[model samples]
Target chain A: MATKSVAKKQVETPDGLTEIRWHGRGGQGAVTAAKMVAELALGQHKYFQAFPEYGPERSGAPIVAFTRVSDEPIQVYAGIEHPQIVVVLDPSLLSIVDVTKGAPDDAIVLVNSEMSPTELRKHYGLEGFRYYTIAATRIAVETIRRPIPNTPMVGALTRITGLFPIENVVNFLREDFGKKFPPKVVEGNINAITRSYEEVQGE
Target chain B: MATTDRDILAVTGNEATAEAMCQIDPDVVCAYPITPQTEVVQLYAQMVADGRVASEFVTVESEHSAMSAVIGSAAGGARTMTATSSQGFALMWEVLFVAASYRLPVVMTTVNRALSGPINIHCDHSDTMGGRDTGWVQLYGENHQEAYDNCIQSVRIAESMDVRLPTMHMYDGYVISGAIGPLQMLTKDEVQQFIGPYRSINPMLDTKKPVTVGPFDGLHGWYFEHKVAQNRAMDRALQVIQDVADEYAELSGRQYGLLDPYRLEDAEIAIVVVGSTAGTTRMTVDKLRARGVKAGMVRVRAFRPFPHEAFAQALQHVKVVGVMDRADSFGAMGGPVFLEIRAALYDCDPRPQVLPFIYGLGGRDIFPDNIEQAFAQLEDVAKSKKRASSERRYLNLRAD
Candidate 1:
């Protein structure tokens, strides 16, 4: 009777949803991460609700973004529990708030760290199911030369959790980066995403 | 039952309210959902996703953000709506007054659930009462159909341009919030034609056109003007209700405006109640009628700025009015509704001997049998000192 539970959607709602909780630093692109996920889901013609819950959390201070996605439309809008997946863009968050609390025991936890796959598993007690980490920060500093690993971590997030297709994530990066940044920045971001996906933990 | 309109569907009170909101067709809906009230927002979100409605569903973090988002959107000249109940409603207290004072025609549906200290999620008037003076026009709905119908009517009442104030459409939390029933609804085309496009007030957010709102520094006289204008706008809402109800009835073959009377035609004793509590009162009224007692019920529907004229007119022939309040105001009179009802009927010609009875707080099941029991307080007041209980009997709390 050990049937595998299918990968649950981060936001169950197309518009109103169950709830999605994000735990990341201010400059780590946590809020932007939630929005990108929202726009990505929207592009799939799925209904989604996404917003950030921030206090005076300055850069590197943990900020949260919540997304409630559902097929039937979501309404329980306090915070998230029973979240389908959790995107921890900053791997250092493991010592802070319990990111796993809102997640189901069988949920996916995608992190950005230089720790080896075996080292990550040994270092942290990920008891129930799937867990992942990618050296997204190093790639961002090396490739993008910007302290912003938001896009690279997003790549690791997609590669590890399978929440969005890798190809779709690339298209999203191209479009999102093209908005404010120049063409070179867009190419740099796309390059960072591709490199991060290859460097993601696991085989 | 007559053949239902396309927009008509037998749904819960909250769902009805949502359907009406959909009929009114808001441009933005941002909400942090609570039980009972959640369905209203959920239905709108569903409509947005399914292409049944085209509106920006601003999914928010809390009731605070939800209320704030709608305030900004409404101020920016878009019809906006949100829904919450009980604790959720209380949480939005910070921004509820903002929506009102800013004169944004924001339509919010509050499924009237009891406030929590003991943590109950049933029907009561306490939640809505907590929001009474937030400057929003508050209208109470009696049943599922009324909940569905009044939401449509309230939009016209609250957003008449002249009455560009927010409205909180109140329905009983679980009693009507979840109960499904038949309702007459307007056709989509008829609805669209009836409300037309929402023309926002002067000064929307445009870089080309600069405007300031809700600034910290406002002159004292300017504040007075805002209050006076808002008060006068509420007066315009009264007229808008009359016009919209007349128009909606014509297009959809259904009628609604202000108070709905069950009896009170040449009666001496009448019980007044609001929201789903009125349903129980009606059953008691029938029982009272069968017993050969000339007793009736007046379910107060329109509560904001109060239907002072309509209520005075309703109580014209009655000699005794039993006001059953679902919320206690600590030491003032009896219940939230009772105090307001008494205030409205104060200047009446030979005002009825009004008695206030407090019952149904914190989501307790209020039985129909208790309606007469509570109304009997009027007779008891006549016989002995009904004012002996320090104005509250603590029906749910300790009887002390």
Candidate 2:
């Protein structure tokens, strides 16, 4: 049976709320990235919600997570059918899932890809949405010594959307990661974020 | 409302409830690991190990043993608690009645999930709905904030001297349990003051006042009387629930009523629902209202001691009402919520035509359009002055 309602037409999201959907695989920090956006919103005195569309819990499986940031309290608990921003944490998911499904024509689609935005769009025959691309996986490997692209994707999303200042996110990550990880690991993630922020390409 | 000082934090429903549990710092928490609810136990155990709480965390073998241990601890004059979902809740079936009958205020967080034949771990109310008559006071929350608030208030409601019955607050499994949402939190000092000290009644550990618990109530025993008394406490609980909620509102600046009615006063058509679906329904109501439809919603926060009077009063003005239930009662008149609501409106002077809608079972999504269709049906019922059918209808269910 189909699990979600298929939107036949554009559904307007609630006023003053920015809805975002994240596409990634299990064990790739997509859920974590979704939650980090919420935490960033909390720091701005905005209300936020982040939740994953949970299927079977397994590594390497395709996963989707959602985040909503609003100036007012968020009351709706439905899955985001029309996200204003769609972030692709894994480039491999682009082939299997329509990451842009249900999003508006003007929605910002950010992907962690080595190709430039124009080249990536042409390569996939993508249209109608503004695309932003970054070598997020390469950046993560170079700085964080890992292949997880979620943090770098977050940095690119921040730069592409201009939701908040890059320095603020840096400070937030430092304080947040400082509590959980060692100094080296925190610094590595911070480097990965700033590098991705500077290298992301969009028109 | 008082201007209270509160900390706003981003946390999942499980994390929020765990924080509440830590703040309350009960004497003993006996729980086993179960999905959706496992995080509550895991987080609370971390707190206990980290010395953030003084509560004794007992890891039991199964949900049955978890409930059994909580009963024993609460009977022995300890403020006890537990958390479970779906199959875990089903496993606690037999011991649930014993905890309620013994009049122990054993507070529990039952993250609502579907019971399994095909072994699904998703959001549904079948688990809690199945235990509706288990004699436990049930409170449902729409999201993480309400779950946190309900968790804190449940202690006071359950431990009320006049109404000492076990309480279980529920939220949609995974939807709320694993979802991170912003919550305004009371400090540890504030929580401790709000709940006050735990008072133990007929303590088995008390040397001077010796009491026998779980005694054999044979054919000549006051078993029926005991049941009546239990029912009386449940009846008294309605008031206690309100009183505690009122007090909580004063301290937290967030108001809660037995029924949360939105735009229902002047509504021509309305929907009555529970849990996270209430949020989605509210959005639908807003959307329909924008298009000049007099749509409204009444979300039932308190399910057990099922707020019949409140429901009737809130929905009496509407011409048609649709009752949404996440769980179905096999071969019944309709779903549990629908039956209760239909019965509640029976004595109305101009009784509204109520329709039954079963939706979102086994974690099926009920989007805004589906709710709009329900409201459309209600409109049709209002225009024709006829019932849609004698059978229960479904939202977003596949016919094929």
Candidate 3:
């Protein structure tokens, strides 16, 4: 058997499935981000599942959502216990909740903070994981003129993981926005996503 | 527009069910919003507002009124439909019997949730399992795609001349209802071509043909005989359900049946499950199979007209069977499904000692490990020829 620390550092599973967990507050569009990512993956002909874990759903209450992308159809319907990637939609949740719970030692942790990877690693004790930081909230305010960091974080995720073509996310946003929002709002969100994709930094 | 060849879309089970409702284009939809189930009606409401569907969308004050309105709409020569969950279903309990007895083909999508005492708004089978005897044709789905397919197939089953009973197809609340997954959709034209048009016969409000509905039946009346006819219709429903499922499979290439058995052939021990947990159990069965253990599963997709003959035939060869019930039967011998399965398997020559496993009450998550533990118990029962331990056991319960 592998040693405990060695096992903690090893994150590979036999199945080639990628599971992601999102940390955000209520009303921050974390669930929508999970849904959009799943939708984008489905558009690329990949099997995906996205779901939110709810608890006393009040605005600003700590929320957690999950997304799983797989080559084959996903059959397990329970909550994701060990996520390979953890996306934090709310920087303030870093202090409030244990946002890194169940993350593997080699997991990628993405956060919507203005801090650099080195600074966040020092401040939040992010020692054993690959950390990526992006100013998603600032990007959202500059583009969408709102503090909703969902779209920007999605862009940052695209860069950090390179899980799929960014064009897939752009096309999804365009089609979804065409249905719901005005052209101005749609262009703004699209720019927010694009800018965040270029601006995200990792270590 | 006809969707060509399994157009895969990301959708929650609620959205998938409501999308099917939109395609069916029912004459009337009466609904009241509740947690988990509220999204199905909310999406359908938006579709109605956007003129996407021509159904009369009735926003009722409460679930009772919602069901009552549907009953009235169904009686007035319309293809009526509705959706509800948990306490909403409990509130519709009285009207459910009336709708079933009157032979109204009212379709309902019941997102299964735990009933309220402490008032949890999470997933469980207690709500619909309580209504198992309400004379409605009940179907369970393991995921979003199944929920969508079941919703479309239900319309054809309910509206058939031989079986005019209402249908309630359920997926787990939050788990399947709120979770987004890949769902293949049939085009609106394909759904229309499959179900065809609704032609209501013996409508109460028809001017040319006068008909009386739900008059009070005295001791001398045929109320008892009406119930017998309802039972006969339910019996006939088994065949109709299979026929409709086969026809649907031909159209969409997605097949469903009375019960979905996974690797049950030549297996000594098996576990029977319902709703979304069956997906998790299937994965666990695969793991046990790889380890050279003969583990199999039988998922009861259609529970209302409890497929007794089919179940007995499936389980007759097995040495031991585990019935996983998400709802407790309280003081009964075991859970409701366990009792039913036990009764169904009584006459088998080598009768399997069916163990009762109550699990997932009040939205407790049933993981693959928990399922593996159940299979281990089933293996133990298989090894020991005599009865073991308690008659009823709870899986994944934290005793601490």
Candidate 1, residue B240: Cα displacement in angstroms equals 2.1
Tens-digit lDDT track for model 1 on B122-185?
Answer: 6788888877888888888776667767777777777786787898888877656754334557
Model 1 stretches astray by more than 4 angstroms: A1-203, B1-9, B206-208, B219-221, B379-390, B393-400
Q: B52-131, model 3: which lDDT tens digit per residue?
A: 99999999999999999999999999999999999999999999999999999999999999998898999888999999
Rank order (by DockQ, best first): 3, 2, 1
What DockQ does each listed candidate score?
Answer: 0.01, 0.78, 0.79
TM per prediction: 0.63, 0.97, 0.95
> In model 2, which runs have C-alpha deviations exceeding 4 angstroms?
A1-10
Report the C-alpha displacement of residue B5, candidate 2, in angstroms. 5.3
Q: Of the candidates numbered 1 and 3, which has the greater lDDT value?
A: 3
True contacts recovered per prediction = 0.00, 0.87, 0.85
**Residue-wise lDDT of candidate 2 within A76-179, one digit each (tens)?**
88788889999998888888999988887678889989999888867887766778999988999999999999889999998988877899899989999999
Give the candidate number with the greatest lDDT: 2
**Model 2 reproduces what portion of true contacts?**
0.87
DockQ of 3: 0.79
| B333: Cα error in model 2, Å | 1.5
Compare candidates 1 and 3 on TM-score and give the better one: 3
Worst 10 residues of 1 chain A by lDDT: A1-10
